[model samples]
Target: MHNQQQRIIASAAQREAAQAARLKIRAGFDRSTAGLAAGMTQVNMISVAKDWAYDFLLYAQRNPQSCPILDVLEQQHYHSILAADADIRTDFPRYRVWQHGEMVDEITDATAIYTAHPELVTFLIGCSFSFETALQDAGIPIRHIEDQHNVPMYLSNIACRPAGRISGNMVVSMRPIAAERISEAVQITAKMPSVHGAPIHIGHPESLGITAIDRPDFGDASRIAADEIPVFWACGVTPQAAIMQSKIPFAISHAPGHMLITDIPDRAWMN
Candidate 1:
């Protein structure tokens, strides 16, 4: 009975923390949410016009590793089932507006976009950030969080399965894990398939067409210690790559590293 009571209290605390983080983000706290709301689930968001919604849905299905669908809001709706009373438009700390496949503006609030295009269908995809707490608990270090930097993501030569008009190379986020802990890191993350599963590649960045380790296509780069090996995982940012490559007419996505803090706890998705 005591343990059960403790579990309930911890669950409530996680929900409260998630809500508080969203409130601050709604109030214009523009920054990366990498280490924020520690034990809560975080998600990557992308909204596309209703016309392209089916195509994007197919794309996500074909590329589950990089685009695991969590909660999808139908056209004209902004609330997500993952978080009660949460408005998708203003909950994220930062947003990206894409026009003709180019990022035109980076804004703190995305209310205007949804207001202008009420026909947009929003998708909240699983993010790797949801599993960082588990990794930390296992004594695995997340260098980006340790250095106060956003996790480094790179565009890879990996081509996702094409669906309708959506097709693009995969984008991967990299973390340096100590050589000895590589197997343990893999085991911990593999249990949370909804949040990217496990490392797709380890050691050789060149195999993925990523020649530059110190430079990244998205987010800030972290240094890899000599004793560590660079580990890569399929990233939720894959949708943005699709938008850019496919030249989608209009789209809105959470800025890389700035995720939506859902009311759900990270353990909810653990296997």
Candidate 2:
């Protein structure tokens, strides 16, 4: 089944209310928030030991395009100035736990883990949701949303500048845009720098070292229509790649497409 043609753009208040309600359920969902909280900022979550927080923060500073830091919550700090009274541990629908550079398990909630490891620091990174909303406003078609699939992501040949123990290849999200509107999409997304501004590469996927566009390293594969070309944007998931590559003793990150919806307005990130 196909999703509606008219994009669903909700007000900030409406999205926040709905997110809060969804999070209140005792059992968490395994759903993607790709088009949810339409006009609000959706940030990615990362938690590392207090000892490793400095390295991760430095890594984000080194790779702003892929790891834009929105808010840094100190040890056991749950409340965010960017998000009003939102619980980091339970807000996101899903979480990935990593130990020794390996994904140990996927869990619905990390509150218990956080309670146990009081020294873990949380970092909320910027996401592409804001730029995505802008593209929809400009009359560009988002194929993944129409087909109800998570945005396609892949690890690229490009390597991020290493910061201490954190370093890895950059990851990107792909969206198929009509060849004619490719430039228009670039201009629209460029306005939101904090949310991965503009396309890093357009057209051939092999140039970015992607062997098969149909087989993505993360998220669902998207169909590239005959008239459309794939547009790649640096993804927030790059940090997860970094975590896995660096093999941090322990770390936590939001599952791809399941972001932490913040109270900040989408417009706040406009360049």
Best by TM-score: 1
Clashing residue pairs, backbone N/CA/C < 3 A, model 2: 101-247
lDDT of each: 0.92, 0.85
Task: Give one clash count per candidate, in the order shown.
Answer: 0, 1
Relative to the unseen true structure, what is the Cα RMSD of model 1?
A: 3.6
Off by over 4 Å in 1: 1-10
Name every residue pair that clashes in candidate 1: none
Positional deviation of residue 39's Cα in model 1 after best superposition, in angstroms: 0.9
lDDT of 2 at 10: 51
- Per-residue lDDT tens digits of candidate 2, residues 203-271? 988999999999999999999899999999999999999998999999999999887776666766776
